[model samples]
Target: MDSGIITILLPLALAIIMVGLGLELTPRDFSRVGKHPKAVLIALFCQLVLLVGIAFVICKVLALPPLLAVGLMLLAASPGGSTANLFSYLFKGDIALNISLTAINSVIAAFTLPLIVNFSIQYFMNDGQQISLQFSKILQVFSIIIVPVCMGMLIRHFAPHLTEKLNKPLRIFAVLFLILIIVGAIIKESHQIMSYITQVGLATVIFCICSLMIGYFVPRLLGINSAQARACAFEIGIHNSTLAMTIALTVMANSAVAMPAAIYSIFMYVFAAIFGTLLNRFSRDDVSSRTTSPT
Candidate 1:
């Protein structure tokens, strides 16, 4: 809640988390995208295009306040993180594909996130608000995201044993940092927390459901196999809310603009678990049907 924490500590925490992400990644993770170009392209389409459109519609239809609308747009723009890879592994999705998508999305988001958030600010904040991700702020976003990742990648490349030692501790820290940020955002906006939730809750829930569905179904319909489709689903479904919140609190310096991501973080894991369970059930049934059919 403090400006000191917002400007300094929050970004430092995020850099550590991004470094953890990089520790998990390697050069191969980026190159692997070439092997599953369809899955990658389809997931990106859903993430960058369809889901962004969906968030805009939800914002307009719900008549969200300007800051909240921009927050939702920011959340929609965030890339999937290491958490998505865990979900993919649990649900029997293509873990390699998840890693590839995460690797690619993180890079692309440095550019796309600023554009989307700036557009949302212009369109939704027609009330003469001065918040915009101008060129310098865009560079800040780029550095916050890419530099730590590159650092982690280099550490892993150069010192394999140190990377291994840092992995678990960083992962734990990332989770703790996320929880702290969400609580801090709520505390900062305590007076308006409930009001903000009432305004943005349904939009976030609907957006989450739509994200999971579109992430999976669109890929499936396009002839991607079930494993890869599940990977696509989780990758698109689980956004890097910490990144959104950090950018909101620090970059835009608005607690209201962080609320959507904070609230969405509460629901995303629950909804993702339920969705993954349903996918597993249906997958088993499909397998049973095939095994039982005349041969």
Candidate 2:
């Protein structure tokens, strides 16, 4: 595959996903904060603080290559975008809240992602390898995260019906892009994935579980409702590994660096969905059950 394909595919995929995200939301979607501030903050806290800490530990424990390690860190910072909304709908969560979180996370990540990713590169860069940090990487994030999202928002603002019509097909395209990336990664790194499967797979699974835990429990502890807690759980567990892998393979052009994210992209969905289903099962409507949430 051409580096150009990866370059174009990476940003175009993100923009499509972001636009899909915006199409689902309205201005009133963001108004949930004044109505429900604590829940939102708790969810954001899980995303910003706990997920990053969890990824840092995973990278350190596994002693993954520095590029791969930073790639994991990038995953931590990148939260639910297009995927979260679908999961929210599937799991009967509050979709409006999920969209709001997605929109907000995308905006915050514009700055936060660059900082975390650049630092992770420095922190985890292996001794033998030399990688350059470029300002264009920041621009890439903006192009992917900001530009299409704004376009979608504008469409929503003016022509909501068109936005609605485009929504389904765009989502389908996002899924196809993800599948292609996953397949490409697998084909390119077959032996590397097989050799490092135990280490990286364990890290991905553990991190996914940890994210689900922190996402759900943290919000409940903050006195959020079970539905809101459910939203956070899915959002936290589901990372934007596509962005991380893009940074690794397309921008950084490091196959080893891209592996963690590529592997994580596979693992998180399985583990997170099961975790969400389990949460759906065990959770009770009783206020007491969720209010305490077993710490």
Candidate 3:
């Protein structure tokens, strides 16, 4: 809630979490994109294009306040969270594809996120409210994202054993930090929390369901295999809310602009688990039907 924490501690925490993400990554993750170009490209299109459109629609239809609308767009612009790999592994998705998507998406988001958020601010904040992500702020976003990731990659490349030792602890810290940021954002907006939720809750829930469905079904319809489709599902479904919130609180310096991400974080894991379970059930039924069919 404190400005000191927002400006200083929040970014430091995000850098550590991203560094942990980098430790999990390698040159292989980025290079692997070439091997599964279809899956990667499809996921990115769904994320960067379709989902952003969906969020904009939700914002307009719901008539969200300007800050909240921009927040939703910011969440939409975020890349897949590192946790998507874990979800993919649990749900029988292709983990390698998940990693590749995360790797590629992270790089792309550094450039696109600023552009998207800037557009949202300009378009939605037409109430004479002056909130703009200028060129310098864009560079800050780039450094906040890419620099730590590169640092972690270098550490892993040079001292893999050390990277291994740090990985689990850092992951645990990432989860805890995510929880803390959500709570902090909520508390900072405590007085308006219910009003904000009433305004943004349905939009976020609908957006989450649409995200998971679009992420999975579009890839499936496009001839991607089930395993790869599941990977696409989670990768596109689980956004890096911490990044959105950090940028909101620190970069834009608006707690209201952080609200959508904070609320969406609460719904994502629950919906993702339910969606993964349904996918597994369908996979099992398909296998049963195949095994029982005349051979």
RMSD of each: 1.0, 3.7, 1.0
Residue pair clashes in candidate 3:
none
Model 3, range 1-295, lDDT digits (tens) per residue?
8878989999999999999999989999999988889988899999999999999999999999999999999999999999999999999999999988988988999999999999999899985276779899999999999999989999999999999899999999999999999999998889999999999999999999999999999999999999999999999999999999999999989899999999999999999999999999988999999999998
Instruction: Write model 2 residue lDDT over 5-96, tens digit each, in one string.
Output: 77776667766777777777666767766777777788888888888888898888878666667667877877675687677777877776
Global fold similarity of model 1 (TM-score): 0.98
Summed over model 1, clashes come to 0
Candidate that beats the other on lDDT, 2 or 3, i.e. the better one: 3
lDDT by residue (56-106, candidate 1, tens digit) is 999999999888999999999999867999999999999999988998998
What TM-score, computed on C-alpha atoms, does each candidate reach? 0.98, 0.90, 0.98
Clashes found in each candidate (C-alpha, N, C closer than 3 A): 0, 1, 0
User: Quick one: ranking by TM-score, best first?
Assistant: 3, 1, 2
Clashing pairs in 2: 66-124
Runs in model 3 lying further than 4 Å from the true structure: none
Off by over 4 Å in 2: 126-129, 284-295
Off by over 4 Å in 1: none
- 79 Cα displacement, candidate 1 (Å): 0.7
